[model samples]
Target: MSNDFYTSSILPYAAIIVKICRAYTNTQEDFEDYYQEVCLQIWRSRKNFNGQSEWSTWIYRLTLNVCLTLLKKKDRQHVASDYLPDEASEGSHVFADESLNQLYDAIKQLSEVDRGIILLYLEEKSYKEIADIIGSNTNNIGVRIKRIKERLKKLLNGKVN
Candidate 1:
């Protein structure tokens, strides 16, 4: 990707990409890798964007799709434990809040689709917007969000086994 594109097009939305990537990755290294791939894919696929939806919406959909797809591929090509980072590298800001960390840890436990749904919901996207991004029925999105919230509450309370 060009530096101009990275700075102008992708960098402006890096926070969104980072949040989506964080939801899908367990380790700092994995988060970096997924973030990079998502940026690359977004640039490569930019032409395919027809401007039917808002730019942020398109970016959200692209980020979630890239993270989930890369996660599945990573699962198939498992790396040895020795290669994994021992402790998270210190710049990620994800651990800044004790409660936020717990919330995300719980979010990470959700299935891929559920994780994306909850992340979008947490972003304050309306149910209709989330349905548009996730390509689910709006009515179903409300039901799913309610269920995901309950699941997350249980997770937070240490009730999930």
Candidate 2:
């Protein structure tokens, strides 16, 4: 890859990869490793990108696939909950707001797939975009979102004092 590509295409999307990694990983070290893997995958696939989708869309698809593949491998279990970083702690300043806490807490209770869906939803991803990433039909994503919302309410409400 050229230095120009590094300076332009890749660096600009660095934060996008990090956001995807955080939604998928549970701790600091794992997030770093996952982020590196995503960078590698993006570089490896750049030559193959035919512009069939937007560059960002292609990268998003690639990122989700990498995370999901890692998640499905028994040997690659993401067991770094104990290594969570201080910045992402339950009491972290970034998430000091009550609704943010409730959302993340509810998210943590969801299965990995559900968590991914909810994160995409919260990111304001179109149902079509999320369905494409997850291999689900676009028409069904809205129903799934509604169900996930109901489940989130139940999950969090059950924990309240």
Clashing pairs in 1: none
**Model 2, residue 138: what's the lDDT?**
80
lDDT of each: 0.85, 0.71
lDDT per residue as tens, model 2, 40-156: 888888989998767877777787778766656623554666344334545542224677655665665666777777877877889988887777888788898898898888877
Model 2 global lDDT (CA atoms, 0 to 1): 0.71
Candidate 2: C-alpha RMSD after superposition: 4.3
lDDT of 1 by residue, 8-124 (tens): 989988988988998877676788889989999999999999999998899999999999899778767876663332133234434578677777778877889999999899889
Worst 10 residues of 2 by lDDT: 86-95
> Model 2 compared with the native: what TM-score?
0.73
Best by TM-score: 1
